[model samples]
Target: MDIVQTQDLRKRYGKVDRVCDLSLHVPEKKVYGFLGPNGAGKTTTLKMILGLIHPSDGGVTLFGQPMDGKNRLSLLRDVGSLIESPSYYGHLTGLENMVVAARMRGLGMAEIDEALGAVRLSEAKDRRVREYSLGMKQRLGLAIAILGRPKLLILDEPTNGLDPAGIQEIRELIISLPIRYGMTVLISSHLLSEIDQMADVVGVINEGQLIFEDKLSALHALSQQALAIRTTDNHAAGELLTAAKVAWQRSEDYLLLNRLRDDNVARLSQILVAKGIGLLRIEERQSSLEDIFLRITGGAVSL
Candidate 1:
């Protein structure tokens, strides 16, 4: 079942279109990765869904209810979000900050320990927010967000400034949320690799337009397979490939062919040998999520 749906969702600032005609469906109890490059309007679209900002046109539905001005307040009670930077009192301790959040959300103090433990911040509860590392701060933010145990958790660029270990920690935590707490997640990130690891469903946006939205497995299956061939005489091999009408491209040290099958590879090898064009190496290459993202977004490689 879809817990969130949007139809022709659009957001504009002055003459600039931040997001345009985006339609999305987020399944229940799944991690939905909102993938895009910087300034692709990912944050804007997220804000619209959270009702933090209104769409210029179109609409959003959460939990089968229309997300308009009337129902936004009540609807937001079931949503927990951590957008951009996580806010905290610099002078307050980790536990102290969580206590503040708990008070604001009408949550019990026991939830403070539970949230901190979930993010593995229990040991650092007494540490001042100013002294915590970037990763710690992020974890604290996540703890605060999940304090009330909302059904939907929306995190925007949650792992933006973390180290490798930190990123992995957060990735594992996000992936575990749906299983452990039955929460549906909508996470936005520019990093394809990160989304590739954590998302069950992926929605890719470019220039404010959602270019692709589907299951992660479906996205993987869309990637094209190619064979890279290195020959002693690449020029001759190119000529032969052109004559045979094979779809191929010349790289710095290899020729990449798109339509190469197992039998075709053998035939090409034979043809190269027959023509005295020495075949050095031939290897099959599968496109990665990064490759697919770059291709779909017209080489937007910022992430």
Candidate 2:
């Protein structure tokens, strides 16, 4: 079942559409990677889903029910979110900070400890939040979000500005959520590599529109393979390729051809050999995820 669904949801500011007709299906107990480049309206789409802002068109559905003003809050009661950044008192200890948030929501202190521990911040729970590193603070925000053990979690650029280690820490924590806590995660990020590592499903948006949505493996399958050939005499190999009218690109060490068949490979090999160009190596190279992303989005976003 889809824990969250949006049907042609749109958000417009002035004459420009910040989030166009967008639909997303987030399955229960799965990590849904809401991917886009900066300024691609990932946050706008997320906000509309959470009812943080009203959509100019269409609507959002949560937990299999249509979300309206009447029941939006109750529907979101089982949801936890850390959007943009977490708010906390700088002078308070991490534990104290959690205490404040818990009291505001009428939750118990015991749950705070479990949340902090789950985020691996229990070792420094007594430290002042002002002294916490950016990573620690981010983890604390995560801890607060999970305080109620919400069934669904929404995170916006959770790993933004994080170091490699911090990013990995958050990645592992997110990956464990569905398994350990039975939570569904809706994580948004501009980084394809991050989503590649952590998401079971992916939704790609660009220019305020949903471009692609599918399983992580399905996205990977969209990448096409190219033939990479390294020959002893590259210039000679280039000449042969030119004469054969085969479209190719010559890098410093290798020549690249697009999706050649087995017979084409044999034909090219025979031609090169007949011309005394020693083929040192030949291999197939799949386009990277970044490459596929750029292609899918029509180069609208960088990284």
Candidate 3:
């Protein structure tokens, strides 16, 4: 079942269109990635879903009910969100902060401890939030988010301040949250690799519009051939590629190609050998999510 649904959902800030005719369907107990560059309206769309802001046009529904009016509060009772940044009183200890939050929602001490343990911050639960590192603070924030045992988890850049280990820990925690607890997750980030690794489904937005939306596996299957070629003579290899009419680009070590008209290895070897350019290596593999992003976004280097 789709726990979250948006049909032509739109939001505007005066003359600027923050989200443009966007539509999305997120399955229950699934990890969905909302990806885009800065100012791409990803956060705006999320806010609309949470009913923190009103939509200018179209509609948003959560848990099969329209998100607005009196029902919004009850709808959000099962939902948790951390938009942009997680805020906590600097003077309050981590555990104290969570305690305050839990009390507001009538949660118990057991729930607070569980949340702390899940983020692996149980040892430092007594430390003042102001003294914690950026990574630790991020984890604490996440702990607060899950304190309610929420069915829907919406995290915006949850891994922003985490270290390598912290990031991996959060990644594993997110993947497990849905499976182990039956929670539905919707996370937004500009990092494609992070989303590629964690998400079961992906929706990419740009300039206030969704460019692509599909299952993670289905989107990766859209492209096939991954070409790898390296040569001793970079300049000569360029000339040889020009003559063969093969589409290729020079990476750090290899010339990456896609959709070639002929056997790139055989044709490249022959041409390079004829031109006295040594063919180092040629390998073919499956395309990655990064390759798909570049292909679809016209090498839209994230700003």
Task: State the lDDT of candidate 3 residue by residue for 91-157, as single tens digits.
Answer: 9999999999999899999999999998899999899999999888888888999986899999998
Candidate 1: worst 10 consecutive residues by lDDT?
A: 259-268
Q: Model 2: residues >4 Å from true position, as ranges? A: 230-255, 259-267, 275-277
Per-residue lDDT for 1-303 in model 2, tens only?
999999999899999999998999999999999999899999988888889899999999999999999999899889999999988888999999999888867899789988998999999999999999999999999999988899999999999888999999999999999999999999999988899999999999999999899999999999888899999898889887888888889766989889799998999899889888889999999988889998999876557
Error of model 1, residue 93, in angstroms: 1.9
lDDT per residue as tens, model 1, 1-303? 898999999998999889999999999999999999999999999999998898999999999999888889899998999999899998999999999999988999788888999999999999999999999999999999899788999999999989999999999999999999999999999988899899999999999999999999999998888889999999999999999988789878999999566787899899999999999998888887778778889998466
Candidate 2 versus truth, CA RMSD in Å, comes to: 2.5
lDDT value, residue 9 of candidate 3: 91
Model 1 root-mean-square deviation: 1.8
Please list all clashing residue pairs in model 1, or write none if there are none. Answer: none
Residue 300 of model 2 has an lDDT of: 67
Candidate 1: where is the Cα deviation over 4 Å?
A: none
Candidate 3: deviation at residue 291, Å?
Answer: 2.4
Candidate closest to the true structure, highest TM-score? 1
Candidate 1 residue 268 C-alpha distance from true site, Å: 2.9
**Number of backbone collisions per candidate, in order?**
0, 0, 0
